[model samples]
Target chain A: DVKDCIIAYFRRSLQQGGGALSGKRALVTAGPTHEPMDPVRYIANRSSGQQGYAIANALADLGAEVTLISGPTTLRKPAGVAVQDCETALEMQALVAAMPVQDVAVCTAAVADWRPAQIVGQKIKKQSRDDVPAPLELVPNPDILADISAPSPSRPQLVIGFAAETENVEAHARAKRLRKGCDWIVANDVGENSDVMGGRENQITLITEQASEQWPRLDKNDVAQRLAALISERLSGKIDL
Target chain B: DVKDCIIAYFRRSLQQGGGALSGKRALVTAGPTHEPMDPVRYIANRSSGQQGYAIANALADLGAEVTLISGPTTLRKPAGVAVQDCETALEMQALVAAMPVQDVAVCTAAVADWRPAQIVGQKIKKQSRDDVPAPLELVPNPDILADISAPSPSRPQLVIGFAAETENVEAHARAKRLRKGCDWIVANDVGENSDVMGGRENQITLITEQASEQWPRLDKNDVAQRLAALISERLSGKIDL
Candidate 1:
């Protein structure tokens, strides 16, 4: 629904002489990484690739070449977009590392923070309550967003990261930009009623160095298109288009 | 994927400890509003109720009776959650108004910035290119996040908003928290490679009045679970839950 709404707005704006986001290349990642705790258990999320898929579709609509790197998802593929499939954060990093630098990169995938130290050749059996909780050692995963945005050989012109927070959402998201060293951040409160993950609409504020532009709530597709259009504007010397 | 991750994390945490989020109520909004131009055309976005739905499911796993006020979404409803569906910002406002005060409220829906001054009853033809550039009448929509979070009779105990920034992401998001009048704000860069919309992973910092916490990239579900756990901690002994 968000995607359809965004497409609607995009079509309308383009019809109204809005900037065309043509001749740009973008890379996006979506869904949650499944870090295995044996074959039976793994660490993953509930993401359905709705946002990333929508963005890829929107970017393509703007005449940009879009490549979507996704974890597992159930959503249908958008028309005329390339999709790269991955699982773990490490795998995502490998894929991103392999890609040539592009005009923009959107990291929407929810990579697992910690993975089991060992895949565990066999699934551990359940024991009595007296037995302590099964402990699978965790090791920190690579920071995919930071790594790509870092001073490196494949640094994209524009690198973005998602900051999903609860308390102190903005502060945390902003800090993440600096810490992760990304160009922009899309911070949303995942506290209660966020339509971000698998829903069709979303409410967000666009933060930049000079000002914060808080848009009224709209569909995620619209948000993506507006953002893409803005990206087009930035590339085309348009101010706040 | 975010919802599943949150639920998995919550179930694990619940098994590990008692009295975590035992009696809290959370309200959230997601997706885009439909600002009608006509029956054929309406304003909306690319949001896919992933984050909001995940948050609610996570909160429920932590023993909270969650009331999710979602906009349009394509994903199946999360188990054991009370869901309210809405289309416009005004509809969401009415729903939030009808509910009892919640312990925490996170407004993540992207409400439309403006709606057509009037929804034309019939679809207009594609007039000449000269007429194509004609500007459509516009009107400002309600600020639902601010309206509910403001110090009013129905304000929730904790309120949070989202900021999606391109440049100066954190600075802008922080300012938005003040401007929008919410207890906390989550800001992140949605620039290149940052999938804040429909992607699965997120990394954010938690900015509070006294301190900040930078979390590594994690699944949106993990993000939700962590937030629910943290919210429960912060609201401990303060609310009935």
Candidate 2:
């Protein structure tokens, strides 16, 4: 009788405040993918994966089954989360496509828009001084967020993407949200001297179909916590999505 | 009498195994320097700065006054070492040029060989599907290691550079050592399947005028310690330069 009572109490606790997202499933992508130019060299972005890692940790803390698909970063994996490491944009796209159904999807990785059309099998040697510099042809990579946000039976109910911009942050973010068919877009300015790409703190604008809210600069962890709380409230039917 | 006794003790200790590089000054460059494509985005490599940071710490342990010029990284600064943060290749070049005379210089940074000839003042928006992809003109960046290795009044006595290659590692490293006029070159392979660029462990080959020695794969920290010991031995006149 005592064991049964304890089991019932714990089951009920799972649906309450602290564990509001206990049964939910979430997928988050973070870090910068490396696109190869040659066997030795690659093209990459400057994303540090701090924001994405923090969000994954926050979701896990709320009892959500979180799968963090990340590129290379020095951060240790969260205790209760599953991690899938990838190197290129294509690899990340494939992994995301193969995942099970998710209630929430956060696409934060700075996927390279273009990759070398052809990768040299060996090291690209330096030419003589008189020769002209080599030309690198590029091709567009698959757009993961847009593909996932498309109307499909397996599409997540809520999809979030990030817009790293330098000018007209709100306008670009809103436009991206409409184009990609994502529910929300987190916009941040990473101009030449903004110090936001690999920095500890960030200032973001949360743009949705109804409103655009500017948030004060805060540590990446705090941002993740706030976002997690909002997601919990919305998923619990306390706030309109 | 007490002060004299203490001075004599420390002088004797300096000649032993540890602290063999006492009173030496070192300058190290690490991480990938960003080259702007537009105000919003940049061109970067996959270097994580782990190797360079480890080398800096190892050198500092040997009682060398170290100055580390680094690009964006999430790692904390090593204790007792001075760090100068930089964003773009130009910024890094200027800072390295202005540093005081050093006895040893290690160029571990994967500096972008080319930067955008002209940076767009505003954000570069995506155009319609029919529009051609944007063209990013390129210009070569200043060769920091070669400049430092040139025979000059302020040149470091022992200059080292890194050659990240995928094939013909020894040949390329030797050629680079000769062309850059550097005393030593540390070569490593970052092939498509090597998983070495941003990974924790590394395999390196130390190339000098006398010989090329291949080292077994090891953790990045251990590699740094071994390299530091070799540097100390060479600088202390225990090994030929």
Candidate 3:
């Protein structure tokens, strides 16, 4: 159902003049990075990657050469886009570091912040009632957004990060934009509106250095289109990044 | 694709004399129980629920009055079966406990052995580089198999548990069978066979008190059909429990 809906919107956008982002290269990350605890177990999030896929499709429809780095998800590849698959956060970081320079970068993937310190070579046995199980030791994952946003001659013209916050959505996002050094942060409160988390609808606030504009809840495709429009304008020097 | 194959197998089996399991009530658990760390994040396994679904369909085709207690999965409800949805190991345990007396029980869900001791009310904020992350405190989840296997007046005549072993498949499963007091343990070596974990084929060993039968690798549907037939014979007093 989600795939059909995404395809329908993608087709509609392709029919319209989508030359706004022509000649611009874009990199997008979609889905949740599964941090492996062991061979059979992982720490993961509920992100369905629907929003990320929609964004990639929207950008592709707008004529940008897009490469989508995706985590493990059930969704099929978006039409007219190149896709690279990775599972854990560290693997995703390596792929991102190796990508060619782009005009725009959108970090929508909900990368896990921590991973097991060591992957147990074997499946951990379920202990008897008397035995106490071990606690999960974790280490911080590579900061992909910060790495991509650092000052460098090869840095993309515009870098966007997404924040799924439970409280103080705007304040947290505003701080994250500064903290991560990204040009903009798309913030959404998944605390109460779980419909926006893995579901089809999304309500987001576009946070830039100068402005924080909350958009009405809309279909994920519409949100992608609007974000693509802003990205095109920013790249064309019609608007600030 | 998996659904079509399963449905086709179910139909072919239905055309055969499937009355062997008639008038018998069966309970089955399927999928991976997601143990939530927060609203958006969870500890999950790479279970696809395909094998479990196939088993449910096969049992139903054999004229068993089946109730499938399943964890979170993307699969649609199987035809001709009653389904119950659950998210965590504790929830699945509760559902199993509440089911009406069953003639046979199949525990195939890949339930997490431990859950976060305390579920964070808010999403855990991604700390700065200087901050050390806290270890994930975990506590053992309820042993659903042991509980269901405990001697009781209403205990099912036949109880089957599944073990996904990376090493010592037969030995671990034999020990598990005795430790959990289940009648049979279906053990599969997932070490060299990752495809069996989530894909559509399985090679398993059925360990019972009397003998161990090593079944050849086959399509998951066919495995289910064979296991269902074994269950029918056991319930009909032709085979040992």
TM, every model = 0.48, 0.82, 0.93
iRMS (Å) per candidate: 24.3, 3.2, 1.6
- Cα lDDT tens digits, model 1, A80-145, are 567788877889889988887788898878776556677764433222212333333556678788
Output per-candidate TM-scores for chain A, rounded to 2 decimals: 0.86, 0.91, 0.92
Q: What is the CAPRI rating of model 3's predicted complex?
A: medium
Of the candidates shown, which would achieve the greatest TM-score relative to the real structure? 3
**Tens digit of lDDT per residue, candidate 2, span A106-131?**
99998877777787787666553223
Model 1 off-target regions past 4 Å? A1-241, B1-19, B128-133, B237-241
B109-160 in candidate 3: lDDT tens per residue? 9988889998988998886954546888888898898888989988999999
Model 1 per-residue lDDT tens digits across residues B162-234: 6555456666666667767887776655544577667787766665555556678888899889877778877
Error of 2 at B119 (Å): 2.8
Which prediction has more favorable DockQ, 1 or 2?
A: 2
Lowest-sum lDDT 10-residue window in model 3 chain B? B8-17
DockQ of each: 0.01, 0.33, 0.63
Q: Give me the candidate number with maximum DockQ.
A: 3
Candidate 2: segments with Cα more than 4 A from true spot: A1-18, A128-132, A191-195, A200-202, A215-222, A236-238, B1-19, B74-76, B128-132, B192-204, B215-241
* Model 3 residue pairs with clashes: none
Q: What does candidate 1 score on TM?
A: 0.48
True contacts kept of each: 0.00, 0.31, 0.69
**List of clashing residue pairs for candidate 2:** none
The lDDT of each candidate is 0.69, 0.83, 0.88
Candidate 1 residue A81 Cα shift, in angstroms, is 15
Candidate 2 C-alpha lDDT tens digits along B1-241: 5654564455345534358678888899999888776664576776888899889878877778789999877677776678999987899999998899999999999887777778788766665322335555667778888889999999998999998887777888899999889999999987667788879999999999898889999999999999999998988889995
